[model samples]
Target: MKKLQILAGLYLLCSSSTWAVEPVVSAANIQEIRLSLDSVWVVLGGILVFFMQAGFALIESGSVRSKNTINVLMKNYMDACLGGLVFWLIGFGLMFGVNQTGWIGTSYFAPNEMDGWHWNLLFFQMMFAATATTIASGAMAERIHFVAYIVSAAVVSGLIYPIFGAWAWGSLFDGEGWLKALGFIDFAGSTVVHSIGGWVALAGIIVLGPRLGRFGRNGQVHYLAGHNLPLVALGGFILWLAWFGFNAASTVKAEVSIGRIALNTHLAACASAVVYMVYTLIRGKAILMRGTINASLGGLVAITAGCATMSPLFAVMSGAFAGILVSILPVLMEKLRLDDVVDAVTVHGFCGAWGTLAAGLFFEGRMFNSEIIAVQILGIMAAFIWGFGVAFIVFKVLDKVLGGLRVSKQHEQRGLDYTEHAELSYPEFQHDVTFETDDMTKRH
Candidate 1:
């Protein structure tokens, strides 16, 4: 009986010991697990955003004439490589470092010693900086000097993008931005990323002037058809897929709300695409492949700011409006004598502004709050002023310093692929074909 009593006592002691230790061990491990999960999600999000570079490259290459295909591809590639390097060295600091009077980041330049979490966030943001820089690559595709474009990309990635980003997103790190303090709600950078990119692209095209024959002496608009519709469609699909990560991962946490965000994104894109096709039909025109693709993208940009906060119905409405904007803005650009190769300004700039306003106008449970709408308008104006104004000045200075931002007439006629890079996307085709000074070649 005494032996039995002793065995029971030992059993209880062992069980009690495990109960005590298990809670302590499990608590520590649960914290670690949460950290690991969050880190993985963030890294995955960065990877998805990085893949967007491929989409940009394919879309831009296909949108340009075959003669300039190689040059466009090269520029997009460098936008990620060279632009990423500059953002890492300087932009990251100016964007996410300690706040300096609610205007800029003051530390973390060329960061090397940040903790793992900070590093992950930096990687994600670096991809965003590269994205903003690449928007101009499409708009400035054919005429821009390769060297000049490279310099501009570095400046934008390292300075303009990050500085504005600091004003709106400084609190992401150790800083606080005035926009955030004013309760501006650009949840996923419709203004900070897309509008900023679009504005810079507008400045670039304005400085570079229209491509030869884009506008006639009598102001007639000429069409510059893309060489490869298949590539354009593929790129659009890829962007659509990657955008799930773009909107959902902005949460930076593994949470239930991601499902809603993803659904909203999908619905908005679909609504915009359908609306674009119908609008084209109503205009007595066949649905254009490029217009449809761009309309979907515009919708995605429009809903990005409000995806988290908007009901799916409102998401659809915002996307439909963006589709209308996509349909009409190209006409306006042509009327204004602007030659935007891929309509980057309309898709990203105007759509981004609309999305920001929608974020407030459609805020769940706080719909049409006047103060919020005003704040959104202020953010939109700030983006245009800083993004377009500074970029215009910088491009003008570069144009003067570099002699000009566009290629020589002869070089432009021969095609940038041959003149700029001594390479050809279609080597089988002869390069001696004469291009008209006032119109694109029949083959194009």
Candidate 2:
């Protein structure tokens, strides 16, 4: 009986010890929990950013003539599809790969043994790559051949975009980069993504030239209005909604910083919109709807590079500055006879540059840093040179290889909807229509 009692006591003691230890083991690991939350937050943000493609499609299609609506939609769709496939295949490797000489990435191709966390990072970045490529679609719309656009999308996502991205944002996870060392801080890629995309768009529009009838023989510029204001407004709203994710979620972790970033983004966008409206009204002109939308977008772009670094007041100032640029830059481009279909250059390129500089100047408490601004300018110049210069050569080569980047005169007149795709956006309406000479519209 004594032996039996002793054995039972030993078993009971061992069971209690095991039960006590299990709770300690299961106690929340703060680091692991934080990482998991970050992953979920970033992935959700990526989905929101992904939806911006729809917004782009609506914006471009609504802005262009109805005859070319289907063509613009296809280009937007292709931007996402081609960007995803190519970025997964090579861009991710190039952007976040092992650093080689601090210029570009060298690793992360599919089928490799990568951590799950790295894959999550890649998914988030793929959306950014797609967005960079899609921005050019609006500028090059109505004129670019489908095949040529495909090539452009592939090259931008696979090479041009990734290479520049590596220069600035490659160190997001690990490894040092030259740009970061030079104190070029783009918190969320105003120059890295927007400027690069904008420069590429600029190159494309320059190469493709103004759409037919956009300018007259006497050097008069004509206005080409979008087909639907309501659709344009919808697109703008969608973009504004997604931008919260774009800026706040860029924090990569659920923290107090996210709220600040969100607030800054919202304030900047609102300030830009209100300022643009007032600016236009003061110029003895009615509030321009397109100007308002572009101003909001420009403000968002402006804040992206500095969203994390700037306070809300500074963010508003940056956005207001961007709003001014958005309102005036397009007009200046038109005066120069440079036709940008949707002011992609003004909103993304110019405002993106300003935003980068603003971040350097208004870096929270720092207020003024000449060194930082110099670095910012260096980044901006590099982006323009690399993005615009490479795209120019690529488009030039593609033009020769594909016979031309622009559609035949006949196709442009008839509209790319019928020429590029046999389907029409509104098949019920007569497809055999041409733009009205008095107004930029199609009539049977």
What's the TM-score of every candidate structure? 0.93, 0.91
Per-residue CA lDDT of model 2 for 119-201, tens digit only, reads 66788889999889999999988888999999999999999999998888784455756787788879888998899999999
Task: Kindly provide the TM-score of model 1 when superposed on the true structure, using C-alpha atoms.
Answer: 0.93
Assess candidate 1 and give its lDDT.
0.90
Identify the candidate with maximal lDDT: 1
Please, what is the whole-model Cα lDDT of each candidate in the order they appear? 0.90, 0.87
Off by over 4 Å in 1: 1-21, 434-444
Report the lDDT tens digits of candidate 1 across residue range 199-315: 999999999899998999998999989899899999999888888888898999888999999999999989999999998898899898999999999999999999999999999
Candidate 2 contains a number of clashing pairs equal to: 1
In model 2, what is the error at residue 86, expressed in angstroms?
A: 0.5
